[model samples]
Target: MGTHVIKMPDIGEGIAEVELSQWHVQVGDLVVEDQVLADVMTDKAMVDIPSPVHGKVIALGGQPGEVMAVGSILISIEVEGAGNVREGSEAPPAKPAPAPVSEKPVEVAVVEPVAKPAAVPAPAPTRAAPVARQPDERPLASPAVRKRAWDAGIELRFVHGSGPAGRILHDDLDAYLAQAEQPAQNVSSRYARRTDEEQIPVIGLRRKIAQRMQDATRRAAHFSYVEEVDVTALEELRVHLNHQHGDSRGKLTLLPFLVRALVVALRDFPQINVRYDDEAQVITRHGAVHVGVAAQTDGGLMVPVLRHAESLDLWSSADEINRLAKAARSGKATREEMSGSTITLTSLGALGGIVSTPVLNLPEVAIVGVNRIVERPVVIKGQIVVRKMMNLSSSFDHRVVDGMDAAQFIQAIRGLLEQPACLFVE
Candidate 1:
């Protein structure tokens, strides 16, 4: 018999550590080679770690939500044959050999002892004693409720538990946050005076976003430009196209038209399709157009790229966009699908306002934002007309793209959108 230790392998992109999102097998569970064991999440993507050898799991290294370093011992397994035992060869003399086939399974603790709850302060003589909790007992709350409280900087302990047996519910956390946001005078009148403030730890995807935004703000000089486009003709063309091929093909969205227009504009202005090398201090231009579409998922914002978008037609572009967006929202997009974009496009659909200054996705030179389209009266050819007007809000890295080039690129898109037929003029 031999025992093998499985170490965390380098998942992708030179990532050093990953958050253990879930565990599929527990200790003492017999697993086979290539069987999935756990799901780990990095900043770029979520990856499933597979078992390397067919064996019985003896121990697990960590629990879910714990950050594990690469090359660290992930889990140990006891295999049948005395083949190559790479990690643990010096077996203890107490258990000279493996247990017989008829023996019961070993019972080892699977949960790690890393994420212990914070120590509670002693209650004052005037107040009742706090509820006793086991050392390993975790706070009883759903993952969504915990995430909401974490995002709102509310501690779970301070939140009054309304669920059965002192469980925290989503409504309880919401009510606590809503009350906390009220005026100090109102809060004092409604509840007892409190002097403590909750401190929430920033981790996971939110931490990555915060760090990247800080880097972008410090490294790049952002300049925003907003222009209103008359999309009445474009909308008419879109509706006609959807009606003609909506059943056979995918439903056409404004994004494909916008993407086509951007491709044309990029051909005219190649400077926007460039990436910056801060260390080398150079801008590298690419011939291929890999456009990224910013998608808001339950986890956070994810940008899934549409590779070689310049070669795809309106229908193909719309199909790929829908597929990528759905994958991102469902947390199923691969790393390749989420990376390697030269520029990005973000839209809020019907929720888009009149104007918004979007932040530049780092290393990329520009980002395009789509605003809500509203119909209003306007003058066209010296005649009163009711037109659908939408605003295009774009931000550029001032260090790379000049103001004139930015204005001209957006103008090119505006012209194409206004004359809808020009978008198909190869």
Candidate 2:
């Protein structure tokens, strides 16, 4: 018998180490090639590590939650039989066949049927044996689709693939779900609900976000200021812009204009763009503006920073934001896209909240909250008129920014929005 060591393989990008989540085999247990031996978790996804050869497991390096680097030895296995040293490759030795049973005559039948001088039969011609069946090979779906199937408790293998080359697609899953007449698959039991709630351990991206949010809250003395702005004129400009240049020109969302207005305001008041150095008791006032747009994702919250926002025009800023948001939603966002944000903006326009107190993005002095815009009655030149109004609420680190400074910053943005011509000024 010979021993073979198994090492961890690279599973995801920017992942230096992984948490050993689970082990499926134990010592002395025989495992086969391609059998899943353990589950490892990186920052992005959980991947199963399979055995490459047939062998009996001899030792485990560590338990679950223990961080292991890539290429680190995970398990040791002992190969069986001579020259079958390839771990987890050879089939387990077959058990010995049971011995044959014998029967005899009831009465004294005597003599073993008189030793018939038996003639040896001619040797039978030999034939070759049939080959063993090979393992199944089907086209795999995208990892995102696979994850969705797992979340919905659906088996991808059983689903009829209708995608290219018989590969499973998201639409295929949707079609199956639409036509399925099986009993309702309840995600959780209503009657079995416990009075005591079970706590789910937050790991991966969610954990990282939680840590940063907590630090932001604890370190910054936040004060929120809210004001309602009449965006009818801005909306009119957007509609005109869209009419001139169709959707192909760009998705003329109000965010770009808002970002532009913020940029202009920051140029005038650079102190508001500063990050507080809590330990050094100093503030880093950046000359160049980098704005982080918080995008909600299936995995958790991800903020993709728009670098050098001060230098980019409104159209360019809109295009970059659109591309980054798409990437974030598709789980294709990179580490660089997520870090080095000097400021952040979060919009709950869809949820329709009138006002909200946005927590400061740590070390950074501010976060801007955009609330839903709806029609409201306002007196215009002594005549009550219906207009689209939205609340712009900004939370700032009070230690660095006073209430007057915060109000002035919002006022400057309001001025730019009120007079859209100001955005064109250098």
Candidate 3:
């Protein structure tokens, strides 16, 4: 057997170093070709590093939360054929793969605690309800299997294993899920004292979010303005369009109309659609309106850009928004899809309260925050009537945008939404 050393690849745009978010395989674990070995975090997204050849994991170069440079050895695998490893290069590989870093985390699992078959006849084939193991035994499975079990809040200890050496496979998990009965909640559990603690390291995409939010707050002079808009007409128009063409075209959401309003309103307030580079002391007013739509995923918040919003119609715009949102949530959004926006739009949907002050997406001077719509009495022509009203809580960089311009910009959006017909008019 020979060692096949895999190096940390250079994920584009001249990134020198990246954070090792998590390792899918550890030493002595058998892995197959195309199996994901680790997940690396760049500025915008999480990238999976896959194995080139089927092998047993022999060594790990870095641990979770470590910042590794590009081209450095990532992991070493033991394969059947002559690997890419050169003669007398084994010693140097050990230097980069520190003894303490690689071996520590695994000790709590199979390496030192329960199972220690070096060429591991691992347990998890797919994972179901734990079965046929001691109380302290750790179940074996692939990273993907573990993730699925984790998301469902299922404990592997009770799961039955049917694979080689009693490894839990997907079939076992499916059987368990299909056949297992839900346990009843214990009455005394509510009052029981709890001592469980979880340590989530601020690494990967989370770390980037923290750094960017801090920088934006420290560097930019942020001020927010709140305005109320009567959206009864906009909702009617959206429903009408969907009722007429939803089967052939697609269903329409309030998001598409809001995006259209921004597109139409920006024609009057071009200054709001810009990126300001503070270090270079330059303000770039882009002709193209690239809007960043914020989406929440299991990992964290991601803003996938809607490129060239000025060009697409309402249906096309909705399709693009849905597509981008899906990609971002599924961890499939590319770097280009995640970057370069002149402005941002954030909405909390039904959870959007009366008002909120959102932080500006850095370099972009403006962000529009949408609130929940509620019907309330309004005095029109000295008569009290119920109308659907919502608030627009928007923020701007006070350094470049004057108070008057910011107010006027939101007012323009309000007029378009209130009228709804003006959005399509040239």
Candidate 4:
């Protein structure tokens, strides 16, 4: 029996350390070559550490959320014949104690010293249901308790109160709910006092997201500007184009149109298409428009960059967005696909409300957030008319972009969207 040790591989790009996100094969589990043993998270991407030789895992070098240096021993495996690690040339990490295996959680309690009780049987006390009040009488409950009762469609007046002076309390409401007979859903089950909790270690992409978000907020002076855009003409154009080219190409979405508008709008606002380097005290303006589209995935929010928005047309940009979004969600997006953006665009689709203050993607000075489009009444010339309206809630690094410049930049996008033809015009 010999031991083979696997060290954390360098993820490259000057990354010194990475977080041990997860372990697929625990101690004593046999693994095959090319089988993923663990997952490590870099600042930009999740890299899978795979097994090179078939063996049984003997030790785990680190726990989840531990930042391990490159070339550090990751896992030790027992292999057939003489393994690469010979007779402890270097000391391996101490094997972690195995967790207690159980089907259900056990609570620890201190034994109390007490006198023996008498052999007398105790009878259960019977309490009648609280008398239901008249429908005209309002139940005395705090606003929060009343809100809960109101949300549950339970008239507090009909619910019996056990509080002093018949004032209803949250626990009283819980008791009433527990006693009530419900057929569709067992509402009483929700009244149970829960002592169970799960502790999820913040690791992988979630930790990276938290770090970047905190860094962005801490390093950059952020300010937000909101503007409403009338997209009646743009939506009509999108629908018409989709109708004509739906079979040949693909269905048109608002994303492609927004990208087109941003690309066009950036021509006049080159200052907004620049990355600010805080340490270097310098800003580099790029002619190319690399738009990072924020995608919500199973792991966390990832921004997959669209290489050059200027080069790709509407459908091409849409295709790339869909592809990158899929890759991000599936944890297949490359580091290149996730980085090097001059600006970012974020939207919550149907979930997007009237306004949202978005965080700036670090290094990039601006992030444009799209809100849901709604048909609202607006006066065109003299009379009130219904029009498709959307709001752009964008944030900028105040140190790099002035308030006036940010406002004008959003106004430019609004103009390009309102006049859809100008997005294609030079």
* Per-prediction backbone clash count: 0, 7, 16, 0
In the order shown, the candidates' Cα RMSDs to the true structure are 17.0, 24.3, 19.0, 9.0
Superior by lDDT: candidate 3 or candidate 4: 4
- As for TM-score, the candidate ahead, 3 or 4, is 4
Candidate 3 wrong stretches, greater than 4 Å: 94-198
Write out the backbone clash pairs for model 1: none
Candidate 1 positional error at 361, Å? 1.4
Best by lDDT: 4
Question: C-alpha displacement of 91 in model 2, angstroms?
Answer: 26
- Per-residue C-alpha lDDT of model 4 across residues 143-244, encoded as one tens digit per residue: 999899989998877666666667787777776676675554445566666689999878788889989999999999999999999999999999999999
Please provide, for model 2 over 1-426, each residue's C-alpha lDDT reduced to its tens digit, 9 standing for 90 to 100.
777677778764667888777678777689999999987655533467899879888777667657888877788777665433365674333222233345763576556656778897565333233223225764468999988888988877667666555667787787667657544444336545457778876754566567778988888898999988998999899899888885677758888888888899998788899878889998888987889898888867777889889888778998999899888777566656766788888887678499899988877898888998899999999999999898998999999999998999998988888788888898
In candidate 3 the C-alpha lDDT for residue 419 amounts to: 95
Instruction: Give the worst 10-residue stretch by lDDT in candidate 4.
Output: 121-130
**Local distance difference test scores for all models:** 0.84, 0.78, 0.88, 0.89
Which parts of model 4 are misplaced by more than 4 Å?
Answer: 94-199
Question: Per-residue CA lDDT of candidate 1, range 1-426, in tens?
Answer: 778777889886888988877779877899998999987878776777898789998777777667889987777788887734545455322212234465677888798679879997555223233344565766678889988888888878787666766677776776677667777777556675779999866655566677778888899999999999999999999999889999999799899999999898899899999999878999999999999999998777888999999999999999899899899887788989988899999999899999999888879999999999999899978999999999999999999999999999999999999998998887
lDDT score, candidate 1: 0.84
Ranking by lDDT: 4, 3, 1, 2
